[model samples]
Target: MSLLDEKQRGAILRALHDLRRAAPARPGEQYGAPGNGSSLLLSLVTVGLVFALWYVATNVGWIKPLFLPSPQAVWMQLMDVASDGFADASLLSHIGWSAFRVFGAFVLAACTAIPVGIMMGVNRVARGVLDPLVEFYRPLPPLAYLPLVVIWMGIGEGSKVLLIYLAMFAPLALSARAGVKSVAIEQIHAAYSMGASRGQVLRHVIMPAALPEILTGMRIAIGFGWTTLVAAEMVAATAGLGFMVLTASKFMATDVVIMGILVIGAMALLFDLGMRWLERRLVPWKGKA
Candidate 1:
């Protein structure tokens, strides 16, 4: 307590307080600072009003039934989720299959992207060699590869996983590269001055410096991956929510179509939540994930 002046201590305390409070949301908002209950209530109220509008619009036929099913119709369909399976696959099965495909490809991307990105960061020669190729493929659309990927890999699980892997891999690699590059030159010098080896410097210094950027990239990649994953499933999948939605549309089972849409949305939300959890766990420096 006596080591610092009172004024300096006060400033430090304030800074710590602000840092601790800087979470994902504002006070009272969902995932916000600890004490902002008002914001949380407001968020809930807004969602409720949206639901109310939706219920009213459908029930009163303000919108045509074809265009917008009433809340009752949607609710009935949702209830049947437990009662009637989706396209011979239970709602649970659809979610499970979709999650499996997305996560499987995501794991592959992470494994391949991280090591190369780290190497790219530490080795100028590697960067020169890889950067051009990475940039070339990075801008291409993931679905653009569908035709060739199917041609090369066939329309089985291989094609589906390959599509998702392509969609997720480039962004992750770029992010890892950026993270590697963002490490301070002086930190590398300091490590060298301390007799640290190149590999050791990369592991202990460059990596930590680049971690924040990497996490940022991962969040973006995961979001892009989720969107592309649906398209992948739509192409040929028989069990995923996207397939169910496509099949339901063929017969105009609009209720089932809506249910599938909701299921996809729910799954996406769950993934986003999982990302938040990971961010919080891995990057405590980030405000609430």
Candidate 2:
């Protein structure tokens, strides 16, 4: 082999030997290769720069500490949280409640949305019924429904869940609809020509093609849920991070507020990363555009 080919061959040989000595993949398995270290380093560097800027900006009072807390104070709060017995409850406790609310709404919306969206996309009658309602509700803010939700469900977890659901539902429904509609016309026709049933067409052609867009919608919906949580938790939550931020506003504890905001941002980023990973795995052809 030439030099480049020899290098590739050597790498493959090494990989094979490593695999032979290593543990086998579990059922339903794929290779667990190392990820892009350069990209990981770049992300770490970006975060470091952002915190440096934040630290400098707040200390110089370029931005009011009321709005932007110092990095040191925020770090102290994080240390407090990590050390134990912080925030009247552990940080994880608050995070657990918040995650429960977000994911509950997200799951509820997705369960209803994916099916409704598929029906709307694949069936003209269903689409006719759904199109007008989605159009009417899509533009309305989930916060706009807060009053009605409270009146209907009380200012309890039920109402909060409803608000999150409303926040997440519309974008996802639209995405599912788009995905369904984007299924190639030729594929449907070909399936029918092959004497495939309507169900078979849906299963084999529409769902597979539409998964990427559906996932895209789900991601958007989750983001909206995150955005809506501040308002949602404004109701009667006593211990959520949202509540912590809201309460800290009175004491002007900008450090805690900033930390809470950063926590929310980190959570959102993590969820987005997870969705992107799922998208890539589920739709290997998604990045073609």
Candidate 3:
């Protein structure tokens, strides 16, 4: 009564078995995985070592005060900014503005890029039309286009958001396109053989299979967007971490510059960690066959 012959069923079972065997031994653990506790400890130790070197260098005059302020001086500057504000705005306000711009651009880029990338992957015409354009812009740095954006959109929020959006768009689109292209042909064939419609196949098979790569792309895009934030905010911006940093550097306020750099690095690290957690939740079989 079964549609699949005995040989077909056996082959399917064997394939499933092999897939399981090829999977990682545990969730979040690949080959030669280290213990989580050990990893955390080692990371903390490395950070401490770097800080110690920084303190010693500043104190011993191995690095000039102008070039690298002491840790104590930087700490005092951070406290001052927290209490008195920087560049006519509080540090928190600057951070808030920066976050708003980055997230706005990132969300817009993700929404448009994912769908367009998926289309490009599935339709040859779409790929032919868009691929050359994406490839051309993808390699150009954000600063290269900043002047044009400012000229067209003005040095307002529109230009800032557009700059970051352009920075994020390419990576997300390319990643999604690559993900779809990487789908197993046999899986598509199997879905079709089961009488699934094109919509059903795309929804249940292609999208799910491609989600991990898409998410990875999103993480990369966010990094690119964040890196472009300084350039974005440098264009007639008054309230942003980038604005604060640029303002401090102009005044030779090394401490403020360092604090801004640290804040940006910390925020980027947190976002990256959050993305990794989301990827694990959404694609539990990411590393599994």
lDDT of 1 by residue, 1-289 (tens): 3534444435534544454466455334464544537766987899899889988998877987677777788778877875777777887887788788888888898899877787787779988998888889888987787889889988898888888888888888888888888765865675566555566666666676677777777767776777787678766688987677778788888877777777777777777778777776865654333
lDDT of 3 by residue, 161-196 (tens): 999999999999999999999888887787667655
Candidate 2 per-residue lDDT, tens place, 97-139, comes to: 8899999999999999889888888789999999899889888
Relative to the true structure, how large is the alpha-carbon lDDT of every model? 0.74, 0.81, 0.89
Highest lDDT: which candidate? 3
Tell me the TM-score of model 2: 0.82
Candidate 1's C-alpha runs over 4 A off are: 1-43, 287-289
Backbone clashes in each candidate structure, one number apiece? 7, 0, 0
lDDT of 2 at 17: 38
Where does model 3 exceed 4 Å of error?
1-31
Worst 10 residues of 3 by lDDT: 1-10
Clashing residue pairs, backbone N/CA/C < 3 A, model 2: none
TM-score of 1: 0.79
